[model samples]
Target chain A: MSGVEFVPLSLTPLLIGVFSAVACALPGNFLLLRRQALIGDAISHVVLPGIVVAFLVTGVVTAWPTMIGAALASLVAVVMIEAVRRLGRIEPGAAMGLTFTAMFAGGVLLLEQSDTSGVHLDVEHALYGNLEALIWLDAVGWESLLDPVALAGLPDELLRIALTLVAVGVFLWVCWRPLKLSTFDEAFAQTLGMRTSWIGLALVVVAAIAAVAAFDAVGSIIVIAMFICPPAAARLMTNRLEIQITWSVVFAVLSAVLGYILAGYGPLWLGLDNAVSAAGMIATVSGLILAACALWAPCRMRSGAPAQ
Target chain B: MTVELISDQGIAPDARHPEESPLAIRGMTVSYGQKPVVFSVDMTVQEGSMTAIIGPNGAGKSTLLKAALGIVTPLAGQAKVFGKPLRSQRHRIAYVPQRASVDWDFPTRVIDVVLMGLYRELGLLRRVRKTHLDKATSCLERVGMADFADRQIGQLSGGQQQRVFLARALAQGADLYLLDEPFAGVDAATEKAIIAVLKGLRADGKTVVAVHHDLATVHEYFDRVFLINTRKVAEGSVAEAFTPDALDRAYGGRLATAQMDRAAS
Candidate 1:
């Protein structure tokens, strides 16, 4: 294969994977620090029902309805989790597990009931993302980069991932301090008039947005993995919040690029003609990075580091 | 002017002139879940004095401080700082919640924790300036944690951790300070150093209120004592409120603290 042939073919999937990974990884750091990493998992599971309901009503798969449905469903999941936690007086982990799995099952059943003749919503696509389907065939030359016709013909999934990344970046840029304070010392932050409760809800909403944006291209498995693995790996590498965030983004980008190549090429080297799921490969690579960082990151190697 | 209107309503005394007192609590009732922890308490902390809130276990000493700081919601009453709500006077009041309330193993250096006091000064989207960084260092020096500023919080001893919390509060530079059990589990030397810092705050004309556990040192370290058992049993200078009668009222007639006070005297 020539450079020209491979460049246009691989560019869209790689960009989509990188942006999707970063979007989920950025907010995942705070969740990990807060010991609310499971909430990210629950949000990913719960948002499925919302998207399905939205598709059922709208009769089409569109970004606005999917986002709105996902956001609302995640909100309901959070509220139900809290209610279970408070009323049953159970541990938060148990509450989250119960609420999300039930909601996800309900969503899957509801999806089963909807007419499937014309719709693309299916259990297989939801479980394993269709990474190979997102191909931008419109780029005839460099003119396609700026031309409106070529741009319109490009895959919408990539745009969704890019906009989600931008949203995550803006959230970090603006609410960094309040988020940090509330995560570390919520009571003191409340005394400082930071409204820690509001900050907490904002965090959940942002996490939901990230999870939902990455859901279509990466599936819930990779979306949940992206929301946790890279940030956790970065956490092992540094003590500063700013540095941890930077390393997480870097790790995510690396996982996206390396994981895609390894998935697409590793099979050929092993005498298998077909490539594997790129999303699954990316998640596996992120997990491997986290495991490596856990063992050898400088901060983890220090004396009496308490073994994270 | 002679009448105290906060007797029954427990509303802050003289709400119109709350500024006359450093901190005011009126008709403050608080609950934990469904159970009431504090009920109908009222008191005004004198300006420029170190006041200790002394009570037996489960007497809501910490809860009262948290309620005043709005860290915990009050069921019926309100607390005021300089005649305004906590949010309005947030920058003017520094609060130290119980040390155990936070995750000490949080992944950040100690200097950053102390620098959190200057966060309100930064407002939204403003970075920490050199002047604020200098002030954070000075505040750490005051609490004797300057050498450990770069270390992680979990690396420190309990007393050192308490001192770091004090340093963070000091960096706030507020007129009113509310500390929840600042001396809990601290070494004698750390306790002495904290007293020196609290006394220094008084000398600087800042009001200091702490949830204190040591009855023997209450009179020696504080200018006033707020004795309570879910209610404000008594609140006045050590000469007036640190009586055996008040201690009996606050501690359900268990006089170990009163006996200890006598032995020390």
Candidate 2:
């Protein structure tokens, strides 16, 4: 509980978790309302292959190439899903299910076959991430907060997720009107010459960016959960889009902070020797919040319909 | 009842000014997959008229409107609005899609949905001003939905939902209004309110086109009628184009005898 242990061991990971949660949840609000929440799951599942492909092509486990690889993979997955939906005359859910699972299976096969013994590239690492290992080794105490030398040693994932969060926020703010109009009524937006198809594509691209970035930091469990749970729970709390968004952000932050603490300390409180997976714990907490909202939120039931 | 058979050639010649027609479609053909839903068809709406697009089920009545607005791609031909392409003249046109087209449960109020009609004027990043709010409120009032401004959209009945959509179109303040099946499922009062609003728009020199299904009210509601069955069957004033022969051709013998008698009466 001292500054020495908390600052060096917990600060960066906690910030990274919060940043990742918010980034995913912001776009998740629109996606959930638009009925495209599965796109988040699709993007996260395909990112593993993207990173593996990047390592194969560049022969390194660096950041930029892997990020680009993940982004490209998601784009390909989206296009493929659309193609299958159109050509095969299948529903979007089935197309997305078929595409992401195939790509993910391909990624696991590649990881098993490739000579990755020298690197920390495995399916488990991709799924749960290494949040516990991302410690600020150079920090001496709380004074490191203002010390340039110690701050420089902070985990790069923290900075990446923070930047992604800011980018996602700006995207939502700038395109707020068009996005809302399009999501609610695509035909109306198109009739007004709003290029609604482009707006829809842009939204999916932004969601893919958030998913890829968050997947790298908090792993796919938290990425998928954050993309749907917070926004869905917020949906039950309010009737206004603006207020719903605020509630989603509040829920995201609460889930990240509380979930991280519970994962790190709750087992110790119960006298267990070790901690649990932060990503899994965050996802579980978000699910719990959504369940509670569904059970008790005032606006949870549809108008004129009996509660099931 | 004796049925008068009008000549099949009812295509109106292109207006010399073109600007006088609020909507002009030329040889528009739309298809879904390999099956053509709407064949090469031409339609010209006189300015300041309330025209009804009537056809039987699967007759592509909605597809024609969607194709005209570029919401659905046409296989061939183009649509002009006031002598220009639809894209350049989008701001001067408004559309009210089918009531069943959107999810009413979306998290928005009635006033907010109406405000969407003014999206073009508001543009991006411009704060909604007092004038925009006033315009939306006035539109809602015109449609008799002002009382439901703060109500969630899902809380309204089917007829109220239709009225809200009309209110949104009214806020567009366009010269030409295109609506699809505005009276498909509504109470008698909502239908009366909607027709009154459409008549007001026409009296103010605004053009109105709607895909209407109720045969009994066609003569009473529309100033003109365009009959279609994959292609143009007849078009002109309701007395001229809504003849029994044209109805039989468009309905392909599917018009029940009682419905035809009601339509004639």
Candidate 3:
């Protein structure tokens, strides 16, 4: 592919995909270890209602209001799940399943009833985001990389996701010790005077932020996939948290790049006319990675048990 | 403060100072939903002594420890450590939750779990220095798990996992150590090593309180015993509290005949 075609069409969307994937996958390592991987799926699913509610309230499609709405929805989902689990004496998985699916159904209902025909708000757009439409139309070639005007014209989604990724990275770096300790043993962390419950809330909040940001750019499919698949696959490859995290990041980037390429050009290479959804392809790629690791990774099975 | 005020009034001048005691609880009650697991119970542990909290299943032995440590919210009462609230004196306390409480398959090495005990010293952002590593290593050595320091936590046997937990507690170097069922599923050799370490802690003037299950070992292992069944049944030295009546009260009809005979003997 010539630099001209790639820089104008693929560059911005590819960067956005990578940034969103990494941001979501970073917190995912801890969440998977803590057995709360489904929280990511729940958060992403509930984001739909949040965005729709934001559109209804503001009477316009703007980034900040929608992002705030999504974040608030994620918080409400988390609290509801906790409340149901505690009050109903139900397990966490059931609580999460019930809450997220109900919220998602409400989101779809709202989308159908609202007058969003004039805008780019729909269930299909929310699920499989228009990654193809997020193009750098102002770019002429590879030289656009250093051009001031072209950089300024970069898609807003890329900048938003980049900032989100940086924020997630800083949170992880600052709270690495407490997060690790608490995720491993909540009671022990509490006994150490760590305010472990608050730490857990903060982690969930951070994850919600990542989910909302990534959901805006790459759609919920990539957000949910990146949140669990890479970290889970990473788990099977190593028995150390530090190494597992590194491997997850690597997997996230690999999925974004490879999945984007396959979605965009793989069909064309096979004499097909159009491309597939980047979000779907990325999720599929991540699942494949997880499956491959499950089958062959050294730490796939418990250390001492006989292999099935 | 009320105790001090009363003592100042020249009533019970020989009253014990709550601060002097390693742990002092007054009327602590914890409930799960409608059922109160631990009723209004008072307990005080002497400094430099090994105390066992023995009770039947669901008698709230673990709940009492958890409530006092502020891990589980109590519906009523206060817990004082060295005469102050638990939060303020948290640094002086070390807790080893049950081995089953955590996911053993977590991806971490034994040394890292021990290093968690130094969390307060390391705080949130400070680099773990050589001194921290040395402290963690020495604690692991104390539990005879120094060689397993580099091993994955999940790879160890149940007894070895218990020892790693003990080592983590030892890393804290706290004045009071609280352990919940430290020997519930350990090999006899591991049990001996753990008891020796606990004895060594008591000898060093540190207080040790454990939720003990084995009625027979109470006499040999602990100098003090606090028996409970939803409420405090008995509390004193083993000679005073480890009686057939107290055992029967705590365990109810659930106490085995062989266990009762061992307690009586």
Candidate number achieving the greatest DockQ relative to the actual structure = 3
- Model 1 accuracy (lDDT, Cα): 0.85
Clashes of 2: 0
Show pairs that collide, candidate 3: none
Interface RMSDs of the predictions, in order, are 3.5, 3.0, 3.1
Tens-digit per-residue lDDT, A1-308, candidate 3:
89999999999889988999999999999988878899999999999999999999999888899999999999999999999999999998899999999999999999989998899898888888878788999999999999999899999988899999999999999999999999999999988888887888899999999999988888899999999999999999999999999999999999999999999989999999999999999989999999999999989987632111
The stretch of ten residues in a row with the least summed lDDT in candidate 2 chain B is: B1-10
Task: Write one digit per residue (lDDT tens) for candidate 1, span A1-308.
Answer: 55455545777888889998999999999999888899889998888899898988888887789878988999999999889998999998999999999999999898888885586777677766777678778776556677787778778889988988999899988999999989999999888887898888888888888888888677887788888999999988987788999999999999999899989999999999999999889999999999999989977743322222
Ranking by lDDT: 3, 2, 1
Candidate 2 similarity to native, TM-score: 0.95
RMSD of 2: 4.4
Candidate 1 on B1-265: residue-level lDDT in tens?
A: 2234445365544344565676888999999888789999998987677899998889999999888888888899988787777668888898887887787777778889998988878876887888988999999999888999888777877788888899899989999999999987777788888889989998888889999877878768998899989988998889998998888889886668556764663
The Cα error of candidate 2 at residue A86, in Å, is 0.9
Interface RMSD measured for model 2: 3.0
Please write out the lDDT profile of model 2 over residues B1-265, one tens digit for every residue.
Answer: 0011122244342344455468999999999999999999999987778999998888999999999999999999889998898988999899999988888888999999999998888888888899999999999999899999999898999899999999999999899999999997788999999999999998888889999999889989998999999999999899899999999999887889637754653
Expressed as tens digits, the lDDT of each residue in A256-290 for candidate 2 is 99899999998999999899998888888999999
